[model samples]
Target: MPLDTGQVDTGQVDIGQVDIGPLDTGPADLDLEEGNGVLNRDPLQSHASIGEALRAVRQDRGLTLDELAERTRVRRSYLEALEAMRLDALPSRPFTIGYIRAYALALGLDPEAAVERFKADEPVLDEPLRAPIGVPDERDPRVAAFIAGAVVIVVAIVLWNVAQRAMNASAPPPPKASEAQAWKLLAETRSGPVTLGPPLPAPVESTIPPLYETPGLAEAGPDGKGNDSAPANINDLSDAPLLDLTTLPATFTPKGKVYDSGNPQLGSLVTLQALNNAALIIRGTSGSVYFARQLAAGEAYKVPQLPGLTIDVSEPSDFQVFVAGQSKGVLPARQVLASKLAG
Candidate 1:
């Protein structure tokens, strides 16, 4: 058979000249198999642990733990535990999975696939289901009575004001006096002018002696010309006895004890005060959160007396910590401050 060089036959084709687009370098989906009512049970699909895979991706991206923590907002210690596969050291299975997903995505890895890998490593505990709460019926008799009472009160108030206005309008006006009658009343009240009297002389001085005068005591300096010496000591006075402080009261008063700052000798009464509106978190030694909320300026929190506690603040300079009534200054931002009380 003869073929034309410029035109290809409809029945014949050249595989070398066909354009199939670019090659697919991405990974392929896992092969699925049906066994024991399960699909896609492949052992080779995930050989490395979730932490191992995440650590590899993170290292390949050349990111440090601190950098990833800043990006993901996960604690560096948590990330370290995740990388080390210390599941017991983590918060919980669900929280750890969430952390894994966030950490994996931060490193440019498939979060869903990473979560699946983590599920396989740790048992996924199902959260207990809670029933929805029911609201009270608004058509109840008590509610209707309350509403009716309120409406009656309002209507009574309106009606009382209307009645008060009507009564004021129906009342008679006060009587007005005529010009002739007013002049007659003024002439009857008028009287003669008052007589003048002469003024009396100033008061005379008394001749009684001062009650406080003494025989030997120098008279008060007369116009600053009398004695200029100091007053006699009260100890020289024989008429009055001095206070016997030594025998009157011999009770011993206890002195207040001074406490050291952040010392273990003091009782566990810890308090935290905020200088600015800021968010903070307080956790126990077991890593369980005891308090997590935003506090306004001058707001304070008295922590329950616990064996140990760790505090984390979003703003370091905005917080003032008190350990056993002693000021510990502001906490370091995003840093954990830990303390323990004496046994």
Candidate 2:
């Protein structure tokens, strides 16, 4: 459109109205798979009754309570309870079946027999424990005197063994003060070495031991393997062998019941002595100390880098402690370091 020069225009116009409603913008429309309405199930096997098992095995072998107890090291009272189906009378389940199975095996019965019996239904234990008859029960009041006498005998024997062991562990037989005084008087009277009864006779060929010898030079193939036919004439030397005393510890526990020095400590290092008059020392690894009781007499134990720490025992049946190759002292059933260890 053409506009004339110097023309001006001014005007205002109105707009139309609009309406708005609420809208759903939140997350939706999720389809979940429902689980099955019914679930699966299973059953367990019933355990064997303790009483039934004990009774069956005992009756099968015809063993009485006393005999069973002696064999299994279980008390007669416990075995009596197990047979009566009185599970509660026994201590714990582990202890109960353990003793029961041991008793069963002593009777040459099957272990499963015990398992079956352990799970069987049991009767209420309203009555006191009873022993199987015809065992000549030593616990009987009638034989109380005899049993007491027998026990005393056993105790005496045990004490005697302990006393003997104590004596052995002590120093070699010592001379009394009176004997020393007599020796002094005798020494004053003596001037020189006394002649032996008589000179020994020359050894006969039969009495002489034959010398050992090897044959002529062996042929070698440079591989270091020599022919046995000719083993090279090597001469043998004879002389008193030198002992490695440094390795022998002066303290030890002998292998005897007189005193079972406890086993070596676990994780402790130990040396296994060559049984024939041999001595060895080893550091305590955790396990070495647990087996110390297993060491025999004539064996030596030494601690590496610690000479004063040692144990020496002789007569595999007796316990003795020697320190620095000399006797420190003797310990009966238990040994403790009585004297101070030289630094």
lDDT, model 2? 0.48
TM-score of each: 0.25, 0.20
Candidate 2 C-alpha lDDT tens digits along 141-174: 7588888999999999999999999989895987
lDDT of 1 by residue, 132-190 (tens): 44655457788889999999999999999999999999999889999999999898778
lDDT of each: 0.64, 0.48
In terms of lDDT, model 1 sits at 0.64
In terms of TM-score, the best-performing candidate is: 1
User: What stretches of model 1 exceed 4 Å from their correct place?
Assistant: 1-47, 125-343
